[model samples]
Target: MALYFFRISQGRYSGASDQPFEFDSREAAWTEMTAVCSNLLSGISRGLRPNSEWRMEMLDERRKPVFCIRLTADTLD
Candidate 1:
């Protein structure tokens, strides 16, 4: 399995969530990202809150995309 660094973008907190969490692996990162997004969408669909947006970025010190899995709110919807 490939290793990656995943980061949640800045200023994404909605007063209910945390800011800027990171994952050490792509699979773990995707799992966390999906869970957060699912919760957010569920909240929005139930009229409990407005849609929250977040950006996902993956960086490679070697400038390669072979081991990256970057996803954002826009990518989900």
Candidate 2:
């Protein structure tokens, strides 16, 4: 297993988890990112959040960005 980090980036705001999650492959981490994006979109549709530029950056144990999933109001349209 390898460690992975999920970092949130929205406009100028940024946050990250100090603890890492162990996953067998990058695909597993990607699956988690997709779920997170889905939840964020749901929150926007439910009027729980303002639709804006949002994304989750997936980083490897070495702190290198592996991929990013981005979302915006246009995504809902």
Candidate maximizing lDDT: 2
Q: TM-score: which candidate is best?
A: 2
lDDT for every model? 0.43, 0.80
Displacement of residue 1 (Cα, Å) in model 2 is 0.9
Q: Write the residue-wise lDDT of candidate 1 on 1-77 in tens digits.
A: 44343443424441222233356666675676567556555544453323434444443333233232223343345
- Cand. 2 Cα-lDDT: 0.80
Please give the range of 10 consecutive residues that has the lowest summed lDDT in model 2: 43-52
